[model samples]
Target: MRRRPSKEQFEQQIEQTAKALHDEMIAGKWAAGSFLPPEKSLEARFGLSNYSIRLGLEQLVQEGWIEKIAGVGNRVVATRPQVKLTIACENVTLRNLKTSGAGRTISAFYPWIQVEFLSMISPIPGTDLSERTLAGDLVLLDNVQFQQLSENRLTHLLEPLSEDDEWYPQFTKHFSVEGRRLLQPIVLSPLVLCYNKAHFRESGLAEPNGSWTWNDLIRHAELLYDGRGRYGFAFHIQSLYRWPLFLIQSRERFEESGEEFLRSRSSRLLDGLKLCKDILHNRKAVPLYLSENNDDINRMFMEGKLSMTLNTYMGLNSWNEAEIEYDISPVPYMDSPRTLLITLGAGINGSSEHKEEARLLVDFLGRCGRERESAYADRIRHYCKCCAQRLP
Candidate 1:
């Protein structure tokens, strides 16, 4: 019979549970006003009593991390503060000035210089102190991202995509974007494919190279299968979105021309679905179902039972914390090496009272110098670049 966890073990489990919930919030898995799993279900999943689960939920609620409705259950309340902005402006150049010319008396000779100064500083307002601009209501205008400057209103919301027929016409009309500044663009990191080095060696298979393709993956999975209890590969169904990385690797475009320009070709989508079904059914190389209810894959990986799994870089961090021996490779490709990327950004609400401050925060993100930009980049770098192919 299996042994029950000791008191110390139980405490550790509670900590792990709390950390998982926190990670989910960071990933935007739980949106605003969405309730998490019920306490009873959580208790079963964590192998704890109702009281222990309640304690964890209560801690989240007290920290303003989440809010508990009278009958609706606990919902994520706290989101990351948008004091910093992340922007993409690869072509624009900015100028730096040590002192302003407001106090100095200037003659007509300064005409050209005055025009240059005004041209540089006119588009961006925060740099000029003499101008009668609203300082608190800072407004940052990037290509597609924005943020608020106020401390109380720090939620990062994404701006609706533009509907310009030139690019995405439907989106342009949806957002009513006839005349609006595009926020700065933010790049997302690619999902990573991870495996256990020790397991590979023990099974007499070579460590997968970064250039391995989908067929290579299938062959490796076949070698690793024991056909007794554990499977060769297992991933959560919800994470199937990453399958597009394989299609990209194969050099297939996700979109094609059609009356409904946004609609995907059924044949291409079927091919992708078949690939997953083959891995899970035809070859029986992976399990068809693996509940993330309690992070079952994570448990299996930590226990040294799983040979391979595909997940985000953040998932790798969890494996490291659990002391699991593993290595990460690029997601397998079909023709070219590519991985799906998921980017995030912040925006000010249209109805926000602190519009100017929000704009300042957004401006700071895009136009700010290297120091601030690097800080933001470093925060999420670990999860952003595992085996990712550069966009050409």
Candidate 2:
């Protein structure tokens, strides 16, 4: 008997199938106005079920890569001159077609950009998309990717989008190179302390505050521990986003690998490393981080398994429906309140022939983050496309 695949496995198969078909289309395997391979042929090619093949094709149709002809088949949309804009996206979560809000946040921006233009949005696989590659006319990028593309000269230096008086000047400067701001910021969040207030009330502990120090966090965390199945403090300490918190706090760059990093002479850097080390080794404070992704850590926070953890606004996207009581505060400071910020923005591909169209998309997406701002999520509601998922 054939064994059934897990949900994750099935989703991976769908993404692989979608990416396989997308890569082929972009590489010009199938000519314009031609119908894609039949479902049976695609099934054999990608080793997916008929349903999975249909779902994969459905994603392409939604992205405008193909159109379904009644009673015929899905035909590849004609390329270029007819369509003024082409969008390239990163599969930050490998989910562009899901019905849920979290899955569709990034995907929903395409329709607004597609207004009055024949456009296709391809969520290029992160592994397949390189630092210097331009998959489409306009690319949706995060802070890091935009900077990388800017450094490599692959992104169009959008002259008109340089300044918005309301935007954080420093962040706007981060996207600029040699007097030209390249990408427009859409959504951003700084690392903050997220705690289960119920846990604090139950534990008779005062809530966290900006004035708290690392030593205070460690002490409160110890008190917060109930010797129950839950851990008082924990995070996916190995995450790139999490691990760097220590170095950034120390105001030092521990940029090295192997023996060189291990033998670094920077005392301030070592001080930060020691903090992370203590927390990881202090089993009474944090649990063993054996699980994958921030979701594993986030699940603990959501289910009341963790009392407190460091998080960004994006991590709380699902908290809208959680029954648990929680609150946010500035992360405990070591030396100062300086914290890491993560931003998602859009950039125009330098090679894009349709510069004006690309600008419109960025303008619409980055237009305003503060209009309906909430105490919890600053500008998240508008750009996250969580107009469907309301935040408290």
Candidate 3:
């Protein structure tokens, strides 16, 4: 015995089908001014009868999303869905973005799409990241948090990057979780050794090279130590950004549990910490008051009180502004050349109603290569690095 849907049930099914198609149209599945598939194809696609398909199309026609002709198929009337993409970010990050001209750039890129930037404050204090993304169309997360979003299924797994999508492999790997790419990297900030040229020249020490090891760096740092207010090496003592480089350089993965990592190379970790302490306290190679504040370190470096420090590309902005004579080099390593990469990226919220618009905004922010310079993306292209392969 088989049961067929009643008239009311059939009509409900048609309404549901209509809503699905309408959402698809709103999602930019098909271009506007183009005809929808034939009724037979629609029947197969939605697993509904031909009458249901017609009813669904008629429903959409009433919604102004499509129009049916006498003999032809249903024509799409609206291509771009009217959606305001809401980007959630921290206050400082938002300020930096505004200062960097992100808003004007995105507006020029997608004139039809509306964008809204929201300061992401927890509903309650310390609600954490998962709760934050649930309310946003797009979210800005650092590399570690971005991976958490993908691992926890909080982000929409984006489509595969095309051949033309330009990104550095080194940076891209930091954002990839499992098998899918969920985050669109917007900034490139990597940990590096920032050296003061004057310090090296005064000490008669040659500039650091890739071949330099941790021992060589320590030696050079000791040589440059003037035993006065000046220091050979200095870095934020309690900084996550700088400490992780020690673990990475030692060919160890970061473990939330210190027990596991310590069992193998407890001495190495101890040695690393001891080295920093000796430089700061015993050797007096670093200013004693120097702690975990980057701004203070940046100020000290700018004042020519420190020789070398571990920093990122962002540090350059301050140094460049101060016109400090500094050059960057790869961080010295113990076993392997490793540097901690810090990046900020955007990912679409899985349950967002404005996925298409959110995607467009993220893509615009992350776009690279030559074509982007010619498109609306050109407005923000100043933030990106241009090369001979791409046109200005």
When superposed on Cα atoms, how far off is each prediction in RMSD?
27.3, 17.5, 7.9
Alpha-carbon local distance difference test for all models? 0.49, 0.66, 0.66
**Model 1 stretches with alpha carbons more than 4 Å out:** 1-187, 250-269, 282-284, 290-294, 314-317, 363-392
TM-score of 1: 0.46
lDDT of 2 by residue, 112-191 (tens): 23322112233322222453345566666656556555556654443435466666575577677777777777666567
lDDT of 3 by residue, 1-392 (tens): 75799989898999899877765665457668888889999889888878778888888887677887789988888444455777877554564455246766766655556777887764321135566444667777666565555567654544333222476554566556565676777765566788999889877889987667777877887788787778877888666556656655544444557786667566565565555555566464656674646767878888888898887654465554666688877777666555666677777777677675677667767764224324534323222222111100
Assess candidate 3 and give its TM-score to the true structure.
0.65
Q: How many clashes show up per model?
A: 32, 0, 0
- What's the CA RMSD of model 2 in angstroms? 17.5
Local distance difference test, candidate 1 = 0.49
lDDT of 3 at 58: 89
Query: Candidate 1 at 361: error in angstroms?
Result: 4.0
- lDDT of predicted model 2: 0.66
Note the residue pairs that clash in candidate 3: none
Q: Residue-wise lDDT of candidate 1 within 242-269, one digit each (tens)?
A: 4555454444454546743345445454
lDDT of 3 at 220: 86
